[model samples]
Target: MKNYKSYIIGLIALVGALQSCVKDSYLEEVNPNAVSSDNYWSNLTESEENLTSVYGGLLNQYLWNSEVEALRSDLAFPRERTRPLNYGYEWHSQSFTNTISTHYFKSWNALYRVIWRANQVIDGLNGMDETFKSQERWTTQMAEARFMRGLMHFYAHSTYNHGEIIIRDKIPTSSEEFSKPLSTSEEAIEFFRTDLQFAYDNLPNTQTQKTRVSKGTAATVLGKSYLYTEEYDLAMPLLKDVIEGPYGYSLLTGDDVSLLFTHAGDYNAESILEINYTDQHARLIQTTDSWDEEAYTTRWARYTAPTNLGGGGTSYFVPTSWLTYEYSNEPVNPNDSRNYISGTNIAKSVPLRCAQMIAVVNDEESTYYNKTPGYEATTFSGTVFSHFKKLTNHDIVGHEDEVLSTSWASGKNMIVYRLADVYLMLAECLIQKNDIDGALGYINAIRNRWGLMLLGADDGTGTFNDVTYTKETLMDHLMYLERPLEIGLEGYAERANDLRRWGVTKQRFEALAAKEYNVVNYNYTKADGTTGKGSLIQEGPTVNVKTDVNTEFDDAAVNFIESVHAYLPLPTDEYLYNQEVN
Candidate 1:
């Protein structure tokens, strides 16, 4: 696994330079003094440099991907009502107004920014000086650009922007071109798959910089597209191409599974694609907010860490009771090392965090924790129980003021695609084909590694016994039960997408709604191995406890969860300001 640290440094500079050039009109103005696009992207080397900006666009997308995609889904519950498009809170407007909407606008804008840059790179590539670089290099760069372009469209089409989105395959130089009519969903999905296939066939098996697109990266996207579309046969081989490819992808085992998230694992063998964020600050809280010194860092950690820990770091997201319960590993065994504090092999208490975090931070008998004995889950009442260690970095207790310790210090290379995710998708593809043994092989491999009882095997935990499954039951198990447990909270909206694909999005969320107003006391393990109590439901009277989403869960959730309303309504600006949509 290579970090390609130098490449990322150069990327930051290029992204900075590119972003500084504001567009006053649809056509970018060319400064006769500066390097213009006409003269700059005239060769393979230059075109490749331009491709870095596309990757920069991807880095920006990652800034808001989890909040916008995952939080609104069943995977996470937002503790605050800041964003219009967030789950588990009330909203000011049913129609997404500009004031309250941030995640939806930024996600849509950033991905399209990638598409915009990709189109520039692709158009420029046509005129690249072949003699400056190898034919293979030029083609590979083109493939990478196409993959980025298609990936942006695929997600934007499926995840947000429910209605038609303007498909920009080429750089738009005129105002007329920028405001074209929207394309249908069928057109978008097929367009997305076509671009991905071209890249899958052309990209190298491995690249010097693991962050760059490769054969495995392209295959995973193509396969995922098919999987979401329910094209079982088409999905299997493409997914298999990534599964058994020469890229050396393997699930992170033992401590490696936990380390899979730290900066040390940025380009590890398991990674297919990841948005690279350096120690540099990533974005301002908004265009109007004072410029943060830590431009390359994300505020995710600030939102996740509990208030008692240090900086009032505990408002944005709280682990749902559903997520907390899933880790209990109840049915298969009394404990499955994955939970927060009460497991045998892995003592588990809190609901959120990577498995190893529990092993390190709060272990059984309190040997490890008793020695440190700092602020523990004791402070977490109804508000914050599962302080998600995925981003919290529990290994280091203590922080400075509110602004996270020295900015960007929360620099953990977030995982976008990894080995376990690939394996589960492969299992899904195989199960659809009635390949039960083969599907179970992949699934059991993951289960066995995590100290979980195999499908039929039962340890001493009364929660376990033996059960058999037919095709439908297995599909149900994989989509609802297996995937949420394995891939939940890592990032993105896969859990929501999983439910949607299984045709259970509305039903599952509606079930969750029943518990919206209900309150629960925090029941956690103590340092001395005794069960201790914490705070009770603490939402003030201002909160509409019955509504489970940012806006009234009933209507806003319907727009977000329903299949036809899969895309969020276009930003308020789309119709009010953009001449095209109006």
Candidate 2:
């Protein structure tokens, strides 16, 4: 119940040496000369070092990982078909399967590690002198720690809440407590909400460094928490404050938005909270030296979309045919700039060949592949694949191999919260509460900014005009079509959870899987003497790439994925360790 501000001030003033002692029984060895709790909080420098260690622990969490491959598996793979990999192996790819047990365990462990470190910091602060607690620095640090703890819990709940009941109570000192019993989904959510509320109350509006946490970030996260809980009314005002308050955030221009994923202007004004990556400091390294290196390079070149110029390969994250068709079919009046900005305008200059390749793949393939053929050179053939184009750093092209190296750092800040996300959430909430007009206004505000035409009528552009609907159904559709396109891979994990909650993934997949589109061959080979025919072939109205693809969300699939598996299980090991304690 102690307020964050007061707690901070108290710890700062009483800055006594805090020892970081480990139990001899718990570890193989101990450092005799290591700073003990007695000296840890005693001096300013030592206290700061302890805090630094806490920050390092925060970064080690699953949510902060660079590659984020687990996210794709946990969120994207089970829900939608962007590509076909292990998806054909129904048991292996299903979220409920034991195949992903390690992923679930790793995620759980990593988050608990973060929480444990935060708890240490919190305890350290608690043990500090009352006089030092009133200081601004101490207050901010404690608040930040609390916020991080909340964030870790938020992710934990999101991952394990499907049906597997898992929970970790606070920070576990002994290995036993680390593996406590799983909390119910509702309980986990409440725990996260509690931490976020503390963070919101204690954190400041701004921070001196961009890397640090602040009030706006806390509020934004809190709003997201509320949105996830389906408490839209509570979320709306908090999100609005983040957008309109002293946060100093604005939507980046299309060009600037593209630059955001590159290392160009990463920590700019538009960022609310970003997992900061630097070329010099904390570089993203390949997990292994040889295979990972090759995989990384191939993926970079083949998966990402080509840069503004034509020299690079296109590895793009192609929008689904359903998404593309929806956009194309929408009303696009000449007067509406929103439609133009939304999808019509070509903000970046891409090669004609690349564009054509993208169209072909989206139209033809039932399951998207990361690598495909494109324009060919004398020595090398272009492979067209889907990549997060926004995150590409063209400046480091020649040293593309070293792009993931610590030295060749690109400054692509991953945005955790943004203004647009909030607006959409508000709209969703309004619609849920039967506030149709209110919802429309919120949606319109976003569209208006993009120069889109009005929603309900057919614009003469051949695309259907926006159609009005009752609040309930309209909200559902908006979340279905609009949200996916708008947020894309940013909140992909969250989207998957929402789909589960709405019980729509199965239906959505069925509808999309049944549709057909045009497919063309982009791989052209020259004949011995003259120009040869390209490998352009139209496969299907609906191409079935695999004969064994699982179309039905069968009981096997359900069993493989627990209802609680929708949320991540608390690391079984943690609860195992703590069984005696409980």
Candidate with the greatest TM-score versus the true structure: 1
> Which digits, one per residue and each the tens of the lDDT, describe model 2 over residues 479-538?
676676555545426566666666665555555446554322333333232333222222
What is every candidate's alpha-carbon RMSD to the true fold? 5.7, 8.4
Indicate the worst ten consecutive residues by lDDT in candidate 1.
285-294
Q: Which stretches of candidate 1 lie over 4 Å from their true place?
A: 1-35, 61-63, 80-88, 91-99, 130-134, 161-163, 280-294, 310-315, 330-354, 357-378, 400-409, 457-465, 514-565
For residues 188-212, write the lDDT of model 1, one tens digit per residue.
8878888998998898988877678
Cα lDDT, all candidates: 0.58, 0.48
Ten-residue segment with the worst summed lDDT in candidate 2? 376-385
